[model samples]
Target: MPATCQVRVLGGFGVTVDGSPVPAHAWRSRRAADVVKLLAIETGHRLHREQVMELLWPDLPVEAAGANLRKAVHYARRALGGPGAIAVDGQVLALWPDGCLDCDLERFNRDADTALASGDARACAAAAARYGGDLLPDDRYEWWAEEPRARARSRYVALLRAAGDWTRLLELDETDEEAHRAMMRRHLAAGRRREALRQFERLREALRERVGVGPDAETVALYETALAEGAEPPSVEQTVAVTLANGLVAWGRRNVEEAERLAKRARALALDAGLGHELGEASTLLALVAYARGTWHEQFRQEFADSVRRSANLENAVFDAHLCFQEFYLYGPEGHEGAESFGRDLLGIATAADSTAGRALAHLLLGEFALLSGHLDEARAHLDLSLTDAERAGCLSAQSIALERAAETQVRRGDRRAAAALLDRAMPLAHSSGIRSHLVIRIHGLRVLAAGGLVEALGAVRDGERLLAEATHVCDPCSMAFRIEAARACVRANDLGRARRHLAEAERISGLWQGGPWSAALWEIRAELRRATGQTTQAAALFLEAAELYSTLHRPLEEDRCRGAAGVR
Candidate 1:
């Protein structure tokens, strides 16, 4: 009995006969495999000899290439164990129909196209899986293989995406920006905002690194929509919580005016509804705005405390969790032990409730606390977990914040390359969500720290200063940090006038926040400026003050650095 001919071309080019492998040496001529692949993939498994000859040996004369084609055909037939396997007419070559020629590429195309046309997602998914890799991956650079391979891969990706098999599509083509965008949209639709935002970042990096281009306008617009306030209030009574959450989202994106307006509206709605939880949430948001606007430290502190008490008394778990998270932001660095306790409580509540956003925020608080305490490895682990939770929950705002903190951790670990890579991945998502100001300023400050030259560092400081001046909430903690960093950068550049101005501004902001983390940074920069200007005694005093603040914050590494700077043990 004649052998059955089987061809596999999806992952690689291969031929078998009667369920037996064709020995590698049997088709020693490179063109033999090429001939078999071409014949199998061609319409009706047939192609004109001249066409095959042209594709396989365009460098040779027509007659010489024809001779080579004949030799290749003979080898192919022998490899298939019979001349009848590949029959040649006067001008055409074909896999003999009677030979029971079966090809995976042909079957994949037929099933995928049919399933797509029928809108059968399950069938399409099954067909798409058959495409294990690019068509004839080994022949990737061959001109003859390009068109069909691309067509197969594109169809496979489209089918997988349509079937909601994002993982498989990504596995097939990691550099496919469209696939990434589709998956991002899917994640967002499923309420996984952090995952969506992370996908956008991955797409941005892949496009930039692989193709030297950014995402198209469509992708950016979609991300912007994802970042926008999307809650729909089902009734007037429910408007307060929806509006409050929207206000929080706006604030996260640094839209101060919009946040304030939404927060005020939410408060009004809460009062009308007589909902204690709504009122508490609204109050918390308003307090955050006040703190960000550089309100007096005592006033902000009292307001936050009042909000927390009200939220706790409401006996609302969600509202209480929100209040606890806010408290951590307000005093977490200065009171690490308290922050840890609150974080653990929030984590427990969120886990029990299966609230992805709450868990993400809890992890972020813990991560930031760990990072501040100089526990680098622990901080990294916490940040990673925070990012994971945020992604799974589809919280873009939390994802962006976690990514920034992760980059900061990398910077502290003295990995400029890793830090830059992280920032590069983060900036696009931040921009998409309209939260780029603070992150951009931080990036500029990081550049100052990492720059090799005084000139470069000074330039970065100027950029950071410009961003701070343009920010909607210039008194935010990050803005204050930017000012201190700018002052230090200017001091290093010997630009005394700008350094003094930035230092004075930082001091003014620090005065509003009192003994917060920014105060330590402000004093450290002041000490540096004083030391540079020959004010040794004042510098020593400022350094000691900074050291004490760091000690209070439980940042022993920073405290020791300050003590050393002050000429103490």
Candidate 2:
């Protein structure tokens, strides 16, 4: 059998044969090693004799170079264990086609190319891990190796950037100016302004220490942007407005306690400043928090009404859009037509303002509404548009939301496999963008539903429940829906205790915030739990109620399911 040979050029140069390192003396002839390196990296592992001579023995006379090439080939063959390892034709030299040769550089390039083509970030990261350093680091000053070294370095850097492995990229080369800029951009995009500023400072210091110069114009501009964004509030009213906006963001992420605190602060500030508009926004945010907490406080309802009245009297298009969104939450399930109309109005306003984020939000809401109404095609169309806008704007949070909702549409359309794939794609975006726990919880719940077998589904539900418990403030409608599904899974697995607990939680939430389209699901799960516990009369009544609710909601499939469960004609 041919001797197995392995060549490694990244970080340094080394060769092994038959699982043992080649003897040091085997590479004593530097020219022979160079010849082998060139052939191994070259396309098809073949190069003409003249090219090799020109590269290695460039300054020698043609006859002398020819003789040197012949001697180097002889040494390379011996080092590789025999003549069969190196093939020499009349004017060309190459590695033997059938020989046992494993080259790290070849493998790295192949892996990188495949990953880049597929746009698989994890695969790209794995490929990038193979790049220990520049090609043949020991051959730093070799003129013949300069171009290939630069090429390899550039490819590796590109792979790291594509994978969003910012920390790893910095570890590989802290002095890389582009990597610094990329990191700053990523942090800023994820709303980590302070981190972006800190990264810029680190880059500036590194550049000044290593090269005695500050960052370039673009890097400096990016730092300035971060600084401007992080600037202190100019006025009390403006500060309160900012606080209210931040609270809204926290609420979206299901951090209800944090949102409540921030909203209270904003309301106090606005009350002191007597800024009606700011106070209105603050009140609206507080109401949103109350809703997320499943409390449905009387104060929340009064505040929501006051905010809507105040916003309607104002000329702020953005505030109007927000108010419209609040209305959707307030009456969406009970008034689908009105909710859809509000969605269209928001879309129009967003488009008029040329706001990608606004447009994406409108599309997401519309898509969700359509999905709830059983308009699968319309849901998909809206979701696709939202995804396009979100991606174009580099809105990672929006992209994750769009993808998660699209996955639900697929699941409802009976394509669990496609839904699973969509969730898989959404997960990285969710992590990178810091998506709210409500969305993440729903994503996990969908994954549980998609998983085959009672055991696997129960395992997923348990894991998701653990995560949900960690986010204690999460009490949104999505959370209620997830609880209902978890209860269903528990029933499927014959875990009556757990199923009852989940069903009770769902019932409590639905009772506090009644009349939503999801109330039907809550009722259906309660019926299932009752049926499992031998409460036949109560189960039948609950099933009939669920069927009535589904029928009112115009959800034919769910209505039929509930009717079947209730044994109705």
Candidate 3:
């Protein structure tokens, strides 16, 4: 009822009824609550007076029913705390959007519609999460209340799942027996079997205590089967969903098999689904898995070709464009003309489609390429655009990733303090969103820490190792990245044996990954390690190889590093 009223319908129908919070003493009648609920759920705050009278007094004669409806409206206004809350305009009864009644349902509905139109999961999740619980739980028996209830429930289920907020969903609706069962299936789909069973048990106990009933048959059976199986790995589809999330968990651990398995499964699923946004998710995840393992070139070519051939809808088309930008960043050259060209094409399409994720992605990629190519000022502009869009869209994972990349660029250009501050802001957001790419960023952050002398004497070394270990556990590990940092950390610690081992591993992975900005750095790092370990001949050979690769790739900074490491500076 106040200006820009706040209503949260998701948890329950909570409303600021006419510029005031409905005090406990005010909600004395179910009919009064029902009246407000009815009008709030109507389209455009408009409802017919005759229809309301019929609903409130079905069997009364017309004259008596009219009297009853008027009385009900009067009392409802009083309960809402003012006469200004509701007014009759001839044959119509309406709640003013700005005055005595603001409904969360209306806000949720509006946000959900916008998100659905845009096909952005984060926006959808934010909108859907506003629906706290059953609408008008205090007046659930009213027949007219079912429509808003159903709409809220459906949106919650769809958006929560899409946003991968399984734990939150379970928490919000543990006693909703149907939702509990559905959550089990979702957890299983996401490859979280333990969590699935735990949720089911919680629901079962809650149902038992609250209503003297066990879990629904479907929920019980799912629990039984999953328990009997004793924690098998997730299904291919579920595994793919998790792995597409970026990097493996834990310190210096990678789940290469799982990442590969999930990507493969996603591909199969995509093929079966065909021509839709879901299929595009699969395609993009596969590309990400490829990029994570440093084998993106061939996969990128294949996916780009496939995307160009497809005539999908706006959502799917935009997703495909996002994939191209990611590919260009990971596999294309530094200050990559190719990436920039592809990015322009993709960004244009995303703009036309009004795809928030696509636009954020394009900006992030373009910024990263620009930064690597010595265009730091341009990088800052693009990265800011990326962060702004990501924040507005509520895509925390995308936002964190962009921030981390931007922080790296900042650190490289004598802005160490700013870079650290960015990392601090980004870490929690990244962890909450389950974004594995943060591992790579954190490792880079450690370099800034060492350079800034902010870390303990051996802190950076230990932290670097831990991050590398986690990266390995998730997929085909970023073995080269792990090695480059591990080698540097070890050298700093004066551990020559470990340093050589790490350098050797870096060399192996670099050879496997072939030419790229990162791989070239790996080679140069290996050369430095070799030179430090008194393997002068080997160091010269590795440095020469690295320089040749860097020159071919037009990366003078890296070529210079290789020459310096070879003692030819």
Highest TM-score among the candidates is held by which one? 2
Compare the candidates by lDDT and give the number of the best one: 2
| Cα lDDT, all candidates | 0.69, 0.71, 0.60
lDDT-better candidate, 1 vs 3? 1
lDDT per residue, candidate 3, 1-569, as tens digits? Answer: 34444455455666663355766557566556566667877876767888887776664568997887777778777766566677777788877544534567767777777877787878877877676676666544345665777777787777776666766765665566666777778778888878887776567445432332334435545766666566465554433333333222210135656645654565555555453433455455455557677776566545544443443332333343243345345544452546676666657756765766557766877886786566788988999998987787666656776787787777667787788778777777755642244244444434534356524424655555555433323212323444566566666555555566567665665564445765666666676667666788998988888887777776666677777767777
> How many collisions per candidate?
5, 0, 28
Where is the poorest 10-residue window by lDDT in model 3?
243-252
Q: Write the per-residue lDDT of candidate 1 for residues 231-328, one digit (tens) a residue.
A: 64245534553465457667767888888898779866765555654565566566567767855334333433333334322222223324323533
lDDT of 2 by residue, 1-569 (tens): 25688888888888887888877698659888998889877878889999999887665579999999889889988887788778877778878556678888888888889988989999889989888777886666465776888788888988998898878777766667788898899899999987887796677545422332335656766766776797673458545634654565566577788888988898777656556555646655665556556553354334433333332222122232233234336334664655577667767766765666567767877887787677889989999998988787666666777788798888777788898898898877766642243356667877777765677788888767766643433435556656877889988776665676687777776665558656888889888978877899999999999999888877766788888999995
lDDT of 1 at 436: 44
Q: Against the hidden true structure, what lDDT does model 3 obtain? A: 0.60
**What are the models' TM-scores?**
0.46, 0.47, 0.46
Which segments of model 1 are wrong by more than 4 Å?
A: 1-335, 434-443, 450-453, 471-475
Q: Candidate 1 or 2, higher TM-score?
A: 2
